[model samples]
Target: MTRFSANLGFLWTDRPLPDAIRAAKAAGFDAVECHWPYDTPASEVKRALVETGLPMLGLNTVRGDVGAGQMGLSALPGRRDDAVSAIEQAVSYADETGTKAVHVMAGISEGAEAEAIFIENLSVACDLAMRRRLTILIEPLNAFDAPGYFLRCTQQAKSLIEHVNAPNLKLMFDCYHVGRTEVDVPTTLNKMMPVIGHVQFAAVPDRGPPDHGDVDYRPIFSQIAGLGWDQPLGAEYKPGGDTDASLGWMVKFR
Candidate 1:
């Protein structure tokens, strides 16, 4: 059966993180994930998870200085110290919340120097997460949505994972980004499934619900299931109106 996870980062933004977890549970989601939850204490988040009995699939490392347009720190040259700090903080938080993975965001930058910095930081992240038996995920944000983001394609992410050679490091294959950048979601997914730690989806052009988009997800979901991926697919779409109203698409999966 195809299960789904509500990404609290986009869904239920009207409520608190803990409340959102309960909402996901109430909505019949199998799991939940988030972007950044540092603002909410780990204990409180854990309490909600415990109450709801839904696993926290993953969370991202802090995006350094949003005010400065810095989306992440891991790939920024000369910011190794900050990147390491962000990784440690994310790992600690994930540990406290019983989360399964950490998406190490590669901030805006490009070049051999930036790649080297990202690899160095990822090594550190993988080591820290391995201690907790947690997976470290690296996502490829499309150029349109995240111009200059160091890791921008599955091939690039695959090379990094192979170069790092860490068992704990994996890829976060988001369908929307893949559709925008690579243009062939199913083939890319099949080729990259070996290293995929997580998967997410949204409408291709608007990033809205997956039910209606440039890319039809029915066959894609079927393909993922056919490939033996039993884990819940993360729903990371923006709800144009009330989140509850946007949930009509979820009924098909259920």
Candidate 2:
């Protein structure tokens, strides 16, 4: 059976984190994930998780100073210390909340120096995450949604993972971004499965619910299962209507 994770970051924005979690459980989701829950008290989030018996799949490191247009710190030059601090903070949060993984953002950076900085920062992150038995994931965002973002392609992410050379480092293969940034999503997914730690989905172009996307996820789900991936597929889409109403596609999977 294909399990689904409701990404609380996109869904249930109108409610509190704990309420969102409860909603996911009531909505028949197998698990939950989020973008950043740092603002919420850890004790409260933990209580919700315990109450619902749902695990938080993953969360991202802070997008460094979002108001300043800084997306992430990991690849920014002269921000190596800041990057490591962010990773450490995320790992600590994961440890407290029982989140299984952390996606280290690379920010809006480029060039060889940025790549090198990313590798160095990722190595440090992997080390910290490994100690907590948490997987460290790197996701490739599409340029359209995240222009100037340091990581924008799975191939680039793969190469960075290779360079970092950490067992705990893995890819967060977001099918939506793949559909937007690259061709042949199925082939790319098949090629990258071995290194994938998590998977997320949303509609291409509009970032809406998967049921209305250019990519047909039915066969894509089969392909993932064919590769023996047993984790829940994250629904990281913006609701076209009510978040609850947008979950009609989930009926087939359930």
Candidate 3:
């Protein structure tokens, strides 16, 4: 069977962290992931895992000045130290919590200089992540969501990974974004899976569960199982109603 990993950050926004874990357990999730354990500190993160017995599959690293247009200055020529420091913090946090992967937020300004900067910073992050045994993943946001932001597709992400040539550096293949931008899902998935370290999904336009929107998760998940992807498929979508109410559909399939 294809296993499912619930994203606690989206699933239980209205509830407490402990309650979210219990809900996932009752909903029949095998594992879970989160965006970042911001409100829930490291000790609380550990406690939630212990109390719910839910293994954390993955989480994200912090992006410096995300709101201040300074997202991902790591690759820029002069800001390598800042990037390295950011990566170290995320790595240490991952180590303490038993998570395997972290999202390298590729936030950047719009211009000719952005690409060069991203490449430089990502290369350094990869080197550091390799030492930490961490699979540092880069996610491509759809242009609609991030107009000036760099990295808007799987092919672009794959190129960066190949150029970096580090096994620890990989792509975060988010389906919801892909669904709107790409013509075919499975075909694109097959082409990109080689460098893909993580995946995220929401219904195409609405960012809801599979059934609520046009994307049929059953078929996609079936293909995922056929592909032998044993890693967790992150359900990082907003709920149409109360978070738990929208998840009954997920419980049936998971």
Most accurate candidate by lDDT = 1
Q: Assess the local accuracy of residue 28 in candidate 3 as a C-alpha lDDT between 0 and 100.
A: 76
Q: What's the CA RMSD for each of the models?
A: 0.7, 0.9, 2.3
Listed per model in order, the count of residue pairs whose N, CA or C atoms clash below 3 Å is 0, 0, 2
Task: Give lDDT tens digits, candidate 1, residues 55-141.
Answer: 999999999999988889999999999999999999999999999999999999999999999999999999999999999999999
- Report lDDT (CA) for all predictions: 0.95, 0.92, 0.76
Per-residue alpha-carbon lDDT of model 2 for 185-254, expressed as tens digits? 9999999998999999988778898877689888999999989999999999999668988888897655
TM-score of 2: 0.98
Candidate 2 residue 210 Cα shift, in angstroms, is: 0.7
Task: Quote the positional error of residue 189 for candidate 2 in Å.
Answer: 0.5
- Where does candidate 2 clash, by residue pair? none
Alpha carbon lDDT at 197, candidate 3: 89
Query: lDDT of candidate 2 vs native?
Result: 0.92
Cα distance off (Å), candidate 3, residue 206:
0.4
- Candidate 1 clashing pairs? none
- For model 3, the stretches where C-alpha displacement exceeds 4 angstroms are 16-18, 66-79, 110-112
